[model samples]
Target: MGFSPDSFYIKTLGLTNTDDAEIWEYATTNDFVIVSKDSDFHQRSLLYGHPPKFIYLRVGNCSTSKIVQVLQDEIDIISQFGDREAESILVLS
Candidate 1:
């Protein structure tokens, strides 16, 4: 993976000029889900409403590898549980 720590928490799979709000917008627009450790994103998800999907990690202090593994473990279930009205967070432990 070419992901840096900054890229891990920040949006990286889209257009170069995209901002945070724009990233969120694009995710929804293109059905691309987000996996983030930032609580702010969870807040924004609620404040702005749902995109295609999102995973908000609440797990405390872990290395990037650990975080990636945790997310990979949950990837299959994400789409199964996806719904705009019912989901806004995905606290990984």
Candidate 2:
């Protein structure tokens, strides 16, 4: 996938237990997009909007491989979404 390591949630970043607000702030400051199944970010996007855009995974219970496959299938859509300045959150299942 040639993605340039934008996500900062690995254990090395020490964000394993960080709250949403802190994660939100980090993404905003660093121009990172937050991708998760957590609906908190969806609510946040509704209230705040843009800058640090988000991708909400409505993919109920599934393995990481399944999620990865979903993302791979939607790579074009995701790319288009990333390019759209007016778009903020993308809900992928």
Using lDDT as the measure, the top candidate is: 2
lDDT of 1 by residue, 6-93 (tens): 3333424636656667778777777766777767678787786566466777778888778777766776666466643577656666
- TM-score of candidate 2 to 2 decimals: 0.88
lDDT per model vs. reference: 0.65, 0.84
Clashing residue pairs in candidate 2 (N, C-alpha, C atoms within 3 angstroms): none
TM-score of each: 0.66, 0.88
Residue 92 of model 1 has an lDDT of: 63
- Give residue 48's error in model 1 in angstroms: 2.5
How would you encode candidate 2's per-residue C-alpha lDDT over 1-93 as one tens digit per residue? 323355444345688888889988988888888888999989999889987999999999998778778888898999899999999999998
Error of 2 at 56 (Å): 0.6
lDDT score, candidate 2, position 4: 36
Clashing pairs in 1: none
In candidate 2 the C-alpha lDDT for residue 21 amounts to 95
Candidate with the greatest TM-score versus the true structure: 2
**Model 1, C-alpha of 72: deviation from truth (Å):** 2.7
